[model samples]
Target chain A: MEGCTIIEFILLVIAYFIGLILLGIYAHKRTKKTAQDYFLANRTFGPVILFFTLAATNFSAFTFLGFAGKAYDSGFGQYGIMAFGTAIMAVMFYVIGRKVWKLGKEKGYITPPELIGDRFNSTSLRLLFMGVMVVFTIPYLATQAIGAGMLIESVTGASIGWQIGAIFTMFVIMIYVIFGGMRGSGWTDVIQGVLMISALTLAVVFIAINLGGFEAANTMAYNASPELFTRPGGGDFFMPMMWFSFMLLWIFADPMFPQIFSRFYTAKDEKSLKQSMILYPIVVSFLFLCPVLIGIWAHGVGLDVSGQKDMVLPMMVANYAPGFVYAFVMVGALAALMSTADSQLLSLSTMLSHDLPFKKRKISEINIGRMLIVILSLFAILFVITSYNPREGIMGTLVKTTFSGLAVLCPTTIAALYWKRATKYGCIASILIGETSVFIFQYNILPTFGLLSAIWAIIIAIIVLIVVSYLTKAK
Target chain B: GLWWRQSEPLMFGLPFWVVYLLILTLITSVAFYLFSKYYW
Candidate 1:
């Protein structure tokens, strides 16, 4: 909280940005002029880069800020829901990702829509997939900007507003992604992923020691809010049905994320993808515990994060850790969001350029993709600055909008991959009907039967896909 | 749900369910490793 410490934090952040720009320049030099090279890094990612990029891309503001905030509001059940659910998702990385990788490498597919469209031989389905991904991903991208804005506002003690922080975060991400493309983002992800894990581990250690170590901290938290230690935690948020719903949701939704989906194509071989899958659960199991523990400990230590639970991690760090630790942790937090936003912008841009039926021109697709990154980033920044409300909290916003909407695509995707009988009509109906149901359920227009809207949406989409596929198969 | 709802018998300062979940994650990781080595 010292002015000097704030100065140190600003300096460190500037230096970090410089390092990223340098990496971007290096990647730009390595990048070939082809669309595949820019968008998919020429399918040359080794195991290590693939693992880190996948990890860093997936663990966004959602993991760093949103997880802690949800833990603060709900309880430790957050850990069980996230860790176990995501671990289970690693199975899909093989079941789904392996196939996607094989197909992409075989067919030279660049984007998720291209793969799906080629399989079904339907341009309409491809456009629908692209449309859904773009619509859903933008909100998730906004969450990263929102997290950056909140972190800056909290770390600077309001000398800097959230709008400035959000814009600055988007601007830096755009520069690197435009320069380096996937290779740039992938390499930066390696550094950012390391920083993110190291900072969280260090922050947790410092906070635990400050609270008289892990046992004492846990005891204090339990005494302060015993409900957090149980399922259907603090606010009765994680009921049995809801818990089941969440676990199921991650399996379907996570693989469908355009950023994550496109990553399947970037791996050098099946071995790299397999290694990433195996490492994912082990890494997630440890990394997630840090923020959840910090959130619970903040409550135990009585940090008064009521209504603004998303700030719990930052508030705790600023109050408990030394200025150096605080500064490093904030940088790590920035790394988390930036790593994700860059990937999201790049993936979305790739889809827009490659999948959409734009008129042919002299401009190469890679250049068009670069221009789209800036445009998409501007839209995300606008969303954060004008539309985002910190009070709604990141977790709730993501679950309601992005997570549920994307999750609905799972059935269609699965059928597309696994079921030979799946027709274009079935895929189209599944997506349209499923997404509509998600919208309806999210708005409470229909009942969710004590489950998340995503669960119902997935179910409906699967049935529609099967029935429609059968009915249309004779044609 | 009933078992996890109980808060007694903390392990390493974590609630019983939290430890249980961590153990489950480890088991899942082991499963993934096995799959990666032998099956994948």
Candidate 2:
């Protein structure tokens, strides 16, 4: 039976890859051989495709593994933070996303840096924006690879080790991304996004039934660890200040993520972007509840995932779920991570190829972008094998590092779009000060007053940007 | 905020705070829907 289950899992994984590759080939055929078509899918995504791609890209391994892990370690507040915070971010989707889409369509902007650089008319500012994006996004990207490796390792019982699993996942993602570009990534996101939501919903329902019911599961978990149901949760992680900090952080930071920022340029119309904004909160809020519930319920089932909280969901499925169900959920987890990684790779490639000051060469821009995808994927794989520390937990690392770092860019981006007097020097000073402050707060160089470092960094960045812009305004 | 620190008063198999947040999420969705239809 074990052998049979292993075979079934392997076959499912292979079939999933084949489907993705076929989709990539189809997208390649449809592709117009232009930089615009390759990077932004010719600016033709409708509401449904836009919504799925945006949600899938935004959620990532962080949603699948990290949410559950944090819920296990913290508590129910995890749901409030993500669901509510993301719902609020949808407002920005209209405020920032609409303007970005219009500007991108009008100005022929292909990357986030392009929009910023053109607005400021400064190559230095553009490169700095690109530099901050690439530096921060790589760690987040590495987390996806790490999540994929761990999922593979858990499902196969280490028959194929994490290193191989990580490399293999990156390799497959590279092929599809290079082949399909934006269209391929968008189309696959629709499929993977649906699969991830459905599989997780089913797995959670199945697990709840097995452990009695939703009520019983909650009761058992609460009885085992009552603190989990409250604010400040198990280790006092979500105190009032931190809760407020997170709520504010996601609003400013989420849309700043390079993959998500690049996605704004893909919307076919303002209506499509608006439709996505409406659906985002509803879908993401509900979907997030599934993993958080499962993570908390793992405690109900008496699974002790003390140090390795990220493994809670996988470990629970492995122990209680049928082999087929286990395989399906693992595939869903892979879908979650791969969807995000492919977009990240594509967005990074687009930014580098379009925004950088490359000498005129015979190679087409699309080809150069494709080569960067390969290089970036390999770099991510190397980071996963060499630097990723599993015990720190995905949510903790992201909130401390990626979320905070990218968030500092929000002030600069918003200023570029809305503030006409926003000089390049102002933008440059904001990013420099914002990132440096985040680093300081992260390493405990200064107290956060019980709030996340991001809040402080953003405040500092905003003040610096405003003050600097006023001082350097053109007469 | 301090009132939600206790684990009692489970509403529909979830803590009251969890239920409150879920309700808040539903409200947010409805609000966004209205925003999309009318305001946006």
lDDT of 1 at A318: 82
Task: Tell me the docking grade of candidate 2.
Answer: medium
Once fitted onto the true fold, the runs of candidate 1 whose alpha carbons sit more than 4 angstroms away are: A2-4
TM-score of 2: 0.97
Please, what is the TM-score per model? 0.98, 0.97
Model 2: per-residue Cα lDDT over A138-161, one tens digit each: 988888888898888878878888
Tens digits of per-residue lDDT, candidate 1, A236-262, equal: 898999998988889999999999999
Model 2, residue A141: what's the lDDT? Answer: 85
Model 1 chain A: which ten-residue window has the lowest total lDDT?
Answer: A1-10
Evaluate residue A170 in candidate 1 and report its C-alpha lDDT on the 0 to 100 scale: 90
The CA lDDT of each predicted structure is: 0.89, 0.89
User: Can you write out model 1's per-residue Cα lDDT over B1-40, one digit (the tens) per residue?
Assistant: 1174777788877878888888898788889888888888
